[model samples]
Target: MARPENVKFGVLGKNIGYSLSPKIHKAVFEVLGIQAEYDLINFSKTDLSKADIDEIKHQYKGFNVTIPFKEKIMPFLDEVTEDAWKIGAVNTVRVETKGLVGYNTDYIGFRVSLERAFDWPIESAIVLGTGGAAKMAVAVLKDLKVRTIFTVTREKGGILGTQTLSYERLEALCPRTDLLINATPIGSVQYKDQMPISEALLKKQKGVFDMVYVPEKTKLLQLAETLNIPRINGFNMLLIQAVAAESIWLERELDVMALVEAIGPKCK
Candidate 1:
């Protein structure tokens, strides 16, 4: 049976005014005949704290973590699952009597997206961003046995593992990259017209995947399409991960792709 009532769910992060997660989750919940509501729980990084996060247990049933908070929100949780701990990022948290429990469903989303893509031998890949989502991308790339993975960071120093570099080196290295994954928020509502990596860089990619689902097609994806490169967006990942989060909260395995087909491109 469904756990007592997990009617309240939200996505927590900074500058999340553009998030489509509320609509996406609402659609899925409607299909499941679940009377539930999801919200965008946006907060400025400076104003949020462990006390504020832990207090969420009394306010909402559970919530999704995004962008800047994916890694930053971990310490505030009562428990972090092994998988999320291993990834060092937590994107989903369930509020219960015991406290807040953290989990990583972003990896689940990427893993499924990769499986659905055409079988292209990915010897190397260039992943954009160094936040929680980017960590998921690196983890999934390593799982695919990708030998060389370069993670792009905005600052001077980036994550310790892997070849962490800036955008300056992308063009020079793109020719060897079989996959270009955007883990950053460059293509969302805030940066709708911004393409982090240029058309010249996308031309060298065998495939491209953007982790942002808004606009359905991003500037980066449009460039990828023009380059005739195989492309995938974050819609599928978003759906699968939402299903996973609900399953965790409701304590049941959801038919992921079925729900995807049910929701369709109507939302886009």
Candidate 2:
């Protein structure tokens, strides 16, 4: 019942002209009859100074952090939630009158979406990439008691708590891996046909989850489908996280399904 002036939000990222976050958030605001404006703040690495971050906190009621800056922006935040601190990445920020607080809704999003897709518990997973998204996925998997999770990265060394596997080792690791998640941008719009692992490896997995949802059925998911593997796209995670972010901003639980319906048609 509050007026629209009470709510303002946006997403932060670079070269995110293709992102559906603004539309999704705006639709949620509309469906909830909340006065909110969701926009995008495109900032490159060099543009993310303390002053710049402070300005964003002052300008928007809250903002969602995205690619390339999720981890880097941590230091500029006034405080971070336990999950975000544990994951060492933040995807959502709450700009309160006191200060800015960061949180990782991605963890909640990933776990909720995966549980919906699979009734059974997820024991082990092979997470591809070592970026912020990968960190959040690993944190969620660990929370779910999936200690056997492995990390596959292009470069070696300095990655804590994960057995880095080279591309050559992928085939051997595929069968043992209960869940295969693509946290890299390999299947993103720009990298369409490209995937972190090969089709053969993907076919051997029990399930496939991609963090990139722009191309809804990413090549990774398509390959999984061909092999009859259970797959979940990034859209579900995006929606769940967006809902969580909205809750943080509004200080109330919004209708997640309504928001989903509003943004469903716009998602690719």
Candidate 3:
């Protein structure tokens, strides 16, 4: 079958009025010479039902899912890619003849950004949450051959492939962690002045990656920088993931970093 004549794409999530997706994707479509429209569709899980999903399938060619809905949107999908299935979340989805197909571009985005941020290989990492974002981060870290991946959460322990630790245990494990990642929303611009780990503990790690991008410089990343540890914010990850999702919807590959560099100023 041929591609849709006029592709209509957007992102699905709550509190997305500040999303840069519309601008980034619109720029991409222009460069690719494709006719498309990208927008933001904000709504919580309660606001959508089977009927609403059916309406969306009729109205949209594809759309990206974001925070608070990556996992909640799974039941409505007809098919999910292996990576998305393994990660237990879906950030990108397409309306297929059968139904909707889901995929997780977060993995690609995080992995590529990780490569660009670090010259040397990572041996171990401490993922700072067990939510959908953490799952994607853990998946990429494992694929990159990070020998040990420890997941931490506030509640019960033991998640992913490693034992989960509380916030207190980080002090003891920081010495052995090569990379520390914040996959939680604790440090988001919405929830400011929050740091997942203490500055002292963050100093022990060789590097840090924070998955919060709204403020561009999250508290976690700021703390990492204060400690002189090489740190990366999720802004690049955000742009790269949007690029990945567009590639999936277009069914073609584009230069990831080239696109990133092209959209550099806007991303910041």
Top TM-score hit: 1
Segments of candidate 3 deviating more than 4 angstroms: 44-48, 171-175
Give Cα-based local distance difference scores for all models.
Answer: 0.84, 0.81, 0.83
lDDT of 3 by residue, 1-268 (tens): 4466577998988777777889888888877788889888887544557886787788898999887788888999999998799988899998877889999999888988899899877998888888788888888887878888888888784456876788777666665678988888887756888877777777778988987877878878777767788998888888899889888888887887788778768645
Q: State residue 161's C-alpha deviation in candidate 1, in Å.
A: 3.7
When 2 and 3 are scored with TM-score, the better candidate is 3
Candidate 3 or 2, higher lDDT? 3
**lDDT per residue (tens digit) for residues 184-231 in model 1:** 989899787899887777877789989888878999988888778899
Best lDDT among the predictions, by candidate number: 1
Candidate 2 residue runs with Cα over 4 Å from true position: 1-7, 44-47, 157-159, 171-175, 255-268
The digit string of per-residue lDDT tens for model 2 on 95-124 reads 876788999999888888888887666787
My TM-score estimates for the predictions, one after another, are 0.93, 0.90, 0.91
Better of 1 and 3 by lDDT: 1
Worst 10 residues of 3 by lDDT: 44-53
Candidate 1: regions farther than 4 A off: 172-174
Rank list by lDDT: 1, 3, 2
> Is 1 or 2 the stronger prediction by lDDT?
1
